[model samples]
Target: MLLFDLDNTLFPFRQYWEEANRTTFTSSPLTNGLSYDAFLPLLKMFDEELWPLHVKEAITLNELRVERFIRTMHALGRSVNKEQSQHYFEAFMENLLSSITMDEELRDFLDKLQQSYTLAILTNGKEKEQWRKIIQLNLTSVIPFEHIFISEDIGYDKPDPRAFQHVLKTLNVEARSATYIGDSWTHDIQGSIGVGMNAIWITPRQASSINENLHLSRTIYDIEPCLFHLNRTTTIT
Candidate 1:
């Protein structure tokens, strides 16, 4: 079984995020007089700062979504009411979701992988938005609906051993029989490793130390070599 992360692993999430922000902010009157460049950093900073709190259930998803934009506008010397903040957020999300489309190369790669493995998605996000992204990416054509697991639905987020263990139990697979591929080292890699599953780290960041399972992929398209490495390791073991 092959478990995958939705955002950065399945698609270029950071690229999509930047493009979406640029498109939305540049076109929207809501951002008038605010430099998109300046607003973007503040938006990202607050998101990074507040995301852990969201994951820990310290705040509601709606609060996290609206607060980031509110803080960004405040930093830019603008005030926004809740309605305005929500309007801006919805606009940005629509732009972001609309920008997702599966290219032929990715579709083809997933098609081939589906032939040999039971592919599934394990992601951390609100259920509705995540489903919207899945539909936008056209992932249902390749990955089955039931195989997709959201942390919101599971009640346990990534980096938690229980989440991985739940997937393994539900799938009736031993930990050793599963392999997880994702970009986040703390969440995806460590979570799967904690539960004794094999992991492929899909990252561009330089590793502080080298190890057999730590494969730095430039893109998800580069995953073939990492899978090959895993196969070799399995055979040798």
Candidate 2:
């Protein structure tokens, strides 16, 4: 069995993100002529900074959505009311959802993998948002609907052992028999490892000193060799 992460794993997430931001920023007068290049990092910074609080339940989803925009605008020396922030959020989401599309390369890859493996997606995100993304990408045609697992639906997020365990139990897949593939090191790599499942890390970043020993694939398509080794190792053990 092969399990995968959603964002940045099945698709080129950063590229889509930039496209979404560019569309939204250019269409909005609220941005006050701010360039997408400048707006992207400021908004991304807050999203990353506040995401932990949302995951820990320190803040509600609505609060996280609104606050990120408020902080981004504030950083640019602009005062934004809650209503204005919500407007930005809604517009950005609309643009994002509309801009999301799967390329032929990823589609063909998943199609071929589906022929040989029982594929599943275990991802961390709001249920509605994640499902919309999957649908937008037309994943249902390739991956079974029941195989998609969302953190919100499972009542736990990635990096939580319960989340991984829940999926394994639901699918009746033993830890050793399943291999997880994802981009996040902490959430996908460590989480799967904690459950005794094999994992392939998808990262384009150069290996750092702290992670010199682990093999990393620059793209999801680069995992064929790793998968071969893992399957062989699993069979041997």
Candidate 3:
């Protein structure tokens, strides 16, 4: 069986993120002559810092989603009204949430894999947001929604052993018989490995110092060799 992460693993997430942000932030009261150049730095800070805070419960996900706009506006010496903030937030999320495009080649690769093994998506994120991307990417066309597991719906996030265990139990597969693939280091690599499952990192990002010893693949289309090794190794064991 193969389990996967949603963002950055299945599609070109950075391109979509840039597209969504540019579209949503360039209009209305949100930008008071705020150059995209100025906006870029704020965007990076908010995502890198706030996300970890959201994960740690320092703030709710909803707060994490919208507060960055408020902070950015404030930093730019502009006072944003609630209505304006709300509009910007809604537009940004709509774009971000709906931005994932299904990779036809990935679907083809998965089609071949499904013929031999069970494939499931075990991603960490809010339920609606995750499901939206799943549908947006047309993932259900190949894998059933029933096989896709989201962290919020499961009441646990990855890197938590229980999260991985739940998916394995639901799939009726032993941990060693399954492999987890994702971009996040803690959540996908160490998390799955910590639970007794091998992991294939959708890389070139070395998530940890130990990454040198871990299985790695550059792009979604570049996973054939990894999949082959995984299959052969499992068969041997």
Clashing residue pairs for model 2: none
- Model 2, range 212-236, lDDT digits (tens) per residue? 2234678888887777666666731
User: Whose lDDT is higher: candidate 2's or candidate 3's?
Assistant: 2
Deviation from native of the Cα of residue 231 in model 1, angstroms = 2.3
Runs of candidate 1 exceeding 4 Å displacement:
205-209, 212-214, 235-237
Q: What is the lDDT of residue 74 in candidate 3?
A: 79
Clashing pairs in 1: none
Instruction: Provide the global lDDT of candidate 3 against the true structure.
Output: 0.79
Which digits, one per residue and each the tens of the lDDT, describe model 3 over residues 1-237? 888888888877778888888888676555857888888798688768788898789998777767777777777788776667778878887888766777788788888878877889998888988888888788888888789999999988888999999999988889888888888878898999998887888878632323422578777667667767666667411
Candidate 1 lDDT, tens digit per residue, 6-103?
A: 99898888898899889889988878877877988899899999988987889988999899998888999988988988988788888988888866
Runs off by more than 4 Å, candidate 3:
81-83, 205-213
Alpha carbon deviation, residue 22, candidate 2 (Å)? 1.9
Measured on C-alpha atoms, candidate 1 has an lDDT of: 0.83
Q: Provide the clashing-pair count of each candidate structure.
A: 0, 0, 0
